[model samples]
Target: MNEPLRTLPSIDRLLGHPQVQGLLAQFSREAVVDLARQVVEDARATASQGQPVPSLDTLAQRVARLAEHRWRAGPRRVINATGVVLHTNLGRAPLSADALHAMQEVALGYSDLEMDVEEGERGSRQEHVRYLLCALTGAEDALVVNNNASAVLLGLAALARGKEVIVSRGEAVEIGGGFRIPDVLRQSGATLVEVGTTNRTYLSDYENALTPNTSAILRVHRSNFRLLGFTHEPPLGDLVALGHSKGVPVLHDLGSGCLLDTAAFGLAHEPMPQESIRAGADLVFFSGDKLLGAPQAGIVVGKRSLVRMLARHPLARAVRIDKVSLAGLSATLLHYLKGEAVAKIPIWQMLSRPLEGLHQTAHKWQEAIGPRAQVRKGESTIGGGSLPGETLPTWLVALSAEGVPGGAKELARRLRSHTPPVIARIQEEQVVLDPRTVLPDEEQALLAAVRWALGA
Candidate 1:
């Protein structure tokens, strides 16, 4: 074998060179040596490969690229395009600007995270959002955790572990990430007492299933599906009464938690936590991010005794939310506390944005770049996993080339590649822009994306 060419300079020699020394001076002493060595090694490696070795300036450029990458912040932001509102992949539920502002105010350099500033005494972090949740949901007491699933888990662990939790077979579900009811119960040390058939469960079925071993009448909402005709289940109020009569608490897991009566927004009815409490549920658990338009949290609200029990659970601390989440959630709840700014919640705003308004927005988008694209009336979805069958009325803008056979693919690929990329759907051979998740101010950038996506 040929002897290895000795073009590589020692770290001392490289830094001693006048040109290298100039570049070294730009960096701190420790970093300068390391950066200088990397540059010289890269140059030698190229020469050994029979390629013309790069000059010091070119090496500097290469080093600059590596340095830039090293310093760049990560877990970088991505455009949400999958059309799932509460798109878990893209970090579900974008917080309102006010919520973001509130988080910024308290996220760094703590203020009163757990201190009664008014009394100058230590307070509980849970106290921050307790009153807000109770006020919003009309509950006797409330507590929040990192997520609704955590709230459910803690509740089960605290109340029903080692005892039976009676639920409808049809209502047992695995939400999002393969988190099944049975799995959760097993982990919580609770026994699963599944009652009734998947399609038909009755009040009597629930009543007969209750025994001395039953700790709670657990009613899990069939969030992912709905039963049509010939379905019979006990009303929530009746179930609550039955559980009370049996001397057991009634626990309802309103999974895919919704706060507002979605029916008013032209969607199916999702049981509100407050409604569950009002209907006499001893404990109610739901997600804060879903319909509440709050930060990612699992809110538990019901009788004060149950709430206290949940808060005292050892597992509750493990699933507890951070101070930032509490601050953001508090700000969001404050909007609801005022009782007038419910419309300001981002999720509610997106849900209640009228079809006419979407069409108008589409028209504006089309007007800006319609000559190079197309606009069509289409429907978006209430993604996240709620309202599976209901297709929200929406508007779409499509763009195509001059008879390019795979224009949709070409446009989609380019849009996904763009900085601050655009996400849309491909339907009937056209790229469709759904306005459901697109903010009003983002319309201009969206229009620009259509143009860029098509290379127009």
Candidate 2:
């Protein structure tokens, strides 16, 4: 046992090996040395336990494989094939090319991020996209924060702290990760006053809840889920009227930000920020990453005085978005302004893509992959908690192979292990990929990944 341990290769010897020299070209010397040490230690431990020691050549191969795994494990791009667009687990929304370019440009060098070039003085970073948001949403002013949750916290803290905020019990919904509206209101230091019953909330309920302690009327959209039977809630116009009757402001938290009328694309209409503004919401807030097809941001747009009040709050500084997010958001808003969102934003493109084209692409994938795959009609959904239970007509390429080693489950796992990992759905004992979610150029990569997954 001692003799085999002594025969184990030294760190210096392994570093100078020809196989390791190749790894040195791709990785730093320090990283290679660290991996070599780990492999050699494993071999020595085996030898000390009176087991057969791996040969130097075998250990060298292990070192190389381990190094490659480490190099490739950090944030590689993944192809979404789960039929869930805006998949929250898969980074929610993919940014447009313009947004990516803008982020890159700002990351490489400094810009007028916080500098007013004309006045030659310091300025607010929020101004970068403030005007654009105001213009697009038709709001008096606009502000942005890290996310929708944070925006709610900031808004409540800024305007309603130490006062009661009246909300409809039906609208106080709990979404993913145990986040509840009542919990957020508690953290904001505001007293929550529930107005109506869970399934039915009438305008009179809101009207009766108003008091001298009431600071604002909080109306939260039930974005993640909905109740169909015997559900009633007051309209925004009516809520605004009641708030004004009591001299209180109305705050609307429109979870997913949608600018385009989704009806034109044959999808259900999602509430837009502009609609909330036009409906007399004193302050309107929504998310940038959802229907907007931009980066993660919490956008607050509405009455100039309310927005300014939120901006001046100390909590605003804590939840403000970074420069990169601002840059990406500004560029994404420009797409809406230029009337090219349907062509440039990936989410809109996928939503509006014709089923006929998707079928054609699925057929081509089926042909390229040979008999191991078959094209079939399937349903795709707009995920990320938007448009729940609604699906779009789409096509899928399903894997059909006999005697698969680990069956569909194993094959699905292996596909995710492929380079740039191909994510797919399992339906009726077959792995399926929707062409609508897969980009045109990524079809080749998807095919190769599928082949590798099937062991063909």
Best by TM-score: 2
Q: For residues 23-107, write the lDDT of model 1, one tens digit per residue.
A: 5666676776677678777777767888775654566565666655564566455555444566666666778888999899997
Candidate 2 per-residue lDDT, tens place, 1-456, comes to 477687788888888888998999988899999999999998887788888878778888999899878876566788998878888888888888899999999988998888999999999998998899989989999999999999989999999999999999987788567899999999999999998999999999988888899999999888888678988998899999989878999999888869999888888888999999999999998999999999999999999998899999999999999889889999999999999999999998899899899988888888888888888889999988787677899999898646787788888888898987999998998988988788767878888898787773
lDDT of 2 at 84: 87
Candidates' C-alpha lDDT: 0.78, 0.89
Checking candidate 2 for backbone clashes, the offending pairs are none
lDDT of 2: 0.89
Number of clashing pairs per prediction, in order: 2, 0
Candidate 2: segments with Cα more than 4 A from true spot:
1-73
